[model samples]
Target: MIFDPSPIELPSSYEKVETTGHVFVSHYPPGTPAVTPVVIVTLNRPAKHNAFTPQMVRDFEKLFPMFDVDERVKVVVLTGAGKTFCAGADLEIGFGVGKDRTADHRDGGGRVALAIHRCRKPTIVAMQGSAVGVGMTMTLPAIIRIGYEKGKYGFVFGRRGIVLESCSSYFLPRLVGHSNASYLVSTGGVFPPTSKHFGDLFNEILPDASQVLPRALELATEIAENVSPASSYLNRALMWRDTGSAEAAHLIESRVINHMFGSEDQKEGVAAFFEKRKPNFKANLDDNPPPSVPWWTEIDTGRSPKAKGPSKL
Candidate 1:
């Protein structure tokens, strides 16, 4: 069932000026203070084609962690404010033209990408219109991506004389295979999301642009209402954070499965099945993560050594 995913004012301003999506709560929980289950995050720069900016990057850096920990946010939907999703990075000030040393500089878009990936809630990207360059790459981390049928999309970095950012190096190849990634990046050509080159990059490409956000909200609502948040997050982690060997995979899976089997969601799910009613799975990822949750060596992406100036040296 589809929901009217209109923006209701948050208790406080979860909305930042730039960076992450302009957050909107769709449904309020009955009684006693739960905000909403699903949220729509809009890329608010419609005039400049929703182009990415430095402040936007900083906003996302803060926004995603809030989503990650907020028990109220079970699923997230990312969309743009207007016709075009994002044209790419706003180069009016020029890209990464910062005073920071190259060695210490982290790609801002990549930082946002990492934050999104670490968020345990199921995320959906609503590509309401065309997207380009980092605009397109940023959403690759989402579990589901819904695109407009006519929207033009591209890797676009080669044309700009830059390389891929937003950790697309890791996600794009895995989502669409090395060959597809190579073709998109090597050519740097804009193509429809329906192009043979995209593979399964877009989970669904709708017939019209107007349909994108609604469909994304529908999917988000589905996951928020019925699916077990802990189970869903673990499943995504198992795929994205793979163990090298089959035996290792089996061991981790066994451990997780055993733990999940005894979890509250499992009992609720089983009871709902027997009772013929919808299961209200109360497990929040922040409150209770599955055993061996990280299961992979956590990288310190934020660690930047203080660079000695030439004068100091």
Candidate 2:
């Protein structure tokens, strides 16, 4: 059955967004113009080092799309509330606790990772003190990652007698190469900020944890102020999705160029350059998207049950 996604309702201020429990959603750089704002999602379980639970995983999955569909939000910054970012999953509750596995079930961390991966706006993660296992793996799907120089990261799934979760098998190698990924997964050792591997994981490392969020907000502000919302969303989608080949990318580029050539935003961008003023981008994803936008189709997972087979000899 075909169903439409429910509309997202954003609060007037960051303080008004209902957090429910461990996850807090808010806006960054308060007092900024509403045209293009930066939203922040903070993991608020500081007492437990912001350790994730199944509920936190579900909250993250729901929050990404909420901010993505909101026209006012241009970027999303994910961070932790306290000194440490996340110390991985909460061991007290245990993983896979109450889940029924009679049929195929998706990993909880994978759900959150995929949500961030599929977000239309730019997603940035700010890592603080220590991030291990699912904590480190979940951030792999973000577009940009920033952390402290003294931060610690680990992929300890091997030590726990389990495989990596959050689809890290697919994303880890892509970010840090196959050899590095293999070594990290197999060893399950912690990488300190000074380690070469740690440097590879983060885009930039600040002096300490306190600087991570500030740096992230600065970058988000730059993106929100200067770029067009529709262009940013489409650009992110094209890069993340597999275009198959160079020719496929070329075709997409041509289609986008053709659609944007005579767009209102394009004309204003040019005029602003000549006039030496900030360009007012009135085009948005909901209202004035380009004609060739939404170039990809959703994959359908429905299928018939497996047929019975004869016994093998």
Candidate 3:
């Protein structure tokens, strides 16, 4: 079941560049068109240990669609920019509080999770430092996980007074076992990746930080080289979705769609999609959505997707 890859040329669509804002964005890396293109997404906030802010999550939500529809983009690579993969959320400033879940999600309500699960192309989490809070949840949906020898993974929601928003509570237990999931969830402490957990959870572990991405890329390319383009992604998606929290995903989407329905952006989106044109959103979503008095309230599902276990999140 394990694949080892030989280096190959990256397709033209795959380009690695630094954005004007100094963000390192690797786009459409090889494997997408051939097997599953490796789309590398690095958290740009190294100063904050790549702590996922609500804005960052929102950007992710926006960026996700770019890859989702790109048939050339099959596999995805999620990592951080600096020493720490992600040190959880920025506690002092507050993250994910009163944030718009619709704007913060890759597909707005576990759509990313479901896409990751059902992606015919594979996903790999290259963790070299701490992956906490939403950071941890973000990678839970990946098919392959690689942690550096010194890397520490933590789950800190209990200490922070936040419930697992990324639905890690439902997915992590399945990945690492119930007991291990319990210890991390209850304590909000860091745990070294053990063989029992990592062996089952991570596809590989490297000796140093430098080796993590290389090894992941190697594995990605190997899979890309051998598998048929169509079959590789379809198979990967099927395998991943099978392990996801379907109910959790459904709840997420239901909430997001409800929120969107009230927004002018939703109107733009529907008209645009129907007309085969780009949407012109009226709101400045990059600044984050307005806070709701009832943070946990759900909107009426007058026109929501029917809930099916696996088909949901």
Q: Give RMSD to native, each candidate.
A: 9.5, 9.0, 15.2
CA lDDT of each prediction against the hidden true structure: 0.78, 0.76, 0.57
Total clashes, candidate 1? 1
> Model 3 Cα displacement at 8 (Å)?
28
Residue 108 displacement in candidate 1 (angstroms): 1.3
Full candidate order by lDDT, most accurate first: 1, 2, 3
TM of each candidate vs. truth? 0.87, 0.87, 0.61
Q: Candidate 3 — worst ten consecutive residues by lDDT sum?
A: 304-313
Off by over 4 Å in 2: 30-36, 288-294, 300-313
Per-residue lDDT tens digits of candidate 2, residues 30-75? 5443423788888999999998888887787667766656666778
Count of clashing residue pairs in every prediction: 1, 0, 15
lDDT at position 7, candidate 1: 28
Q: Which ranges of candidate 1 are over 4 A from the true structure?
A: 1-34, 302-313
lDDT of 2 at 71: 61
lDDT of 1 by residue, 1-313 (tens): 3332322222333432233343222332223233567766677778888888877777676566656656567888888888999899888857856678989988877987887887777779999999998898899999999999999999999999999999999999999999999999999999999999999999999998988888888888888878888888899999899899999999999888988886889999999999998888877564556668779886766421111221110
- Predicted candidate 3 versus true structure: per-residue lDDT over 1-313, tens digit per residue: 2242232232334343223332345744433433234677777789878865655645554444445434455457777888888876677766444556755533122443543443334677788776777777778877788887677877778887866656576688878789977777788886666535433666676778988877777776665444333334334433333424777556544554455565665566677789986554433322233232122333332111211111100
